[model samples]
Target: MSEFLTWLFATLFVLVVIAWYLTYTAARLDRLHVRLSGTLAALDARLVRRAEAALELANSGLLDGATALILAGAASESLESPAEHGEARETAETELSEALELALTEPVVTHVRDSGPLGQEQLAKLASACTRVQLARRFHNDAVTDVRRVRRKWTIRVFRLAGHTPMPHTIEFDDQMPATLGV
Candidate 1:
């Protein structure tokens, strides 16, 4: 009888340990999920702002073909019904393509008219901004991957048993940024 009791106690202790590990994992996963969501949201807002800036540059007669493409992509995604606006969107895309072709074939002027800094300095700042944005996006994706991996573990099936549903990939926007910032 003592032998049986000892074995039973050992088994119970092992089960408890497993349960604790799973709970810890779930908690960690939840934290990562929240962070990933927030980071993605911020990134999306920044992307929209950049796209708007590109559009503004184009409208200012800057002859920035890249900006035209950015504006077109932003417009395409922002539209609720692509089919309804297909013709107009297509025309815009064609124009943008021509602009890009022209820009690529011609020599690019490295001049910066924003008198605050030299053109090279301004270009460096833009490059740094682009790098930071890409890094943020990568970090967000990494967090998302970790969270999803934890949630998919067989030991974490208890979450499903408790009616916890898996989260879907979501892109959130910052409300503080202008609508142009979230295009």
Candidate 2:
């Protein structure tokens, strides 16, 4: 009878340990999901800002307005949600490609025709702004990729069994670069 009691307690202890481990795993998954969510939000926001900057430049006649508007709209729409798969993400990628092509194409080259060249300082500033926008876009895309990759993991499925859905990371942009670099 004593042995039976010992075994019963052991069984209960084992069950409790299993429950605790599962709970811990679930919590960890939740934390990752949260991080992914925050990163995605930051990424989206940056993309929007970059797109806006491009649009502003284009509107000011430094770039083409049609291309800028298309790019802005594409970037804005891409933030609706994080793409679940390569195929899904490709759609936004294609739109971005189109905008980039338009922005860099013959129309801009032909429209901006003038005998006088831009001053060195003005050209440098424009180049710097363009580079910054490109970097921001890349940073945002990388964050989105990281989040999506985590969501696709098998462990995330286990977490789902415990009633956690991998939250899609949606990024938000900054109006201007804060002292800090993240979002």
Candidate 3:
């Protein structure tokens, strides 16, 4: 009887420990998800700001009509993209990045910088916006990577600690700064 009681108590103790570990894991995962959510929101805001800055530059008469039109169109498409339209949003952002790379040549950047104080300020704002977008995207992607690492754990999968939470995907878009505007 004494041995049986000892074995029962040990089993209950092990179960309690397992329950505690699972709870801790779930909480950690929940926090990571929340962090990922916040980072995504920040990334979205940075993207919108970047589009707005590009559009403003396009409309400021800094570039030739064709270049300006291309910039404006890409920026408009990015701005109009719905958040839930994941692939479409990514495509629009990629198009904007390509447009910026094509339009902001060294001479064009120099010309805009030398145009006047307002042009210089506008170009600076656009450059800053581009930098912010890059940083925000990196942060968001890092969060996704962290969450994915945790989600791949065997314990998480077997116990379904993540519940119905969808796996987070890293955002992949060309967010490189234009060569001439790397400032």
User: Candidate 3 residues 1-183, lDDT tens each?
Assistant: 999999999999999999999999999999999999999999999999999999999999988898899999999999999886378899999999999999888888998999999889888899999999999999999999999999999989999999999998989889987988964
lDDT of 2 at 113: 36
Better of 2 and 3 by TM-score: 3
User: Candidate 1: which stretches are off by over 4 Å?
Assistant: 1-8, 59-61, 64-108, 111-129, 158-164, 167-183
Whose lDDT is greatest here? 3
Measured by TM-score, the strongest candidate is 3
Q: State the weakest 10-residue window (summed lDDT) of model 1.
A: 174-183
How much is the lDDT of residue 178 in candidate 1?
21
TM-score of 1: 0.55
Write the residue-wise lDDT of candidate 2 on 80-149 in tens digits. Answer: 4354424455465445435545554544544443313442222233344445645655565566566566
Ranking, TM-score, top scorer first: 3, 1, 2
* Candidate 2 wrong stretches, greater than 4 Å: 64-93, 105-183
> Model 1, range 2-35, lDDT digits (tens) per residue?
9999999999999999889777876776677678
Q: Backbone collision count in every prediction?
A: 0, 12, 0
Better of 1 and 2 by lDDT: 2
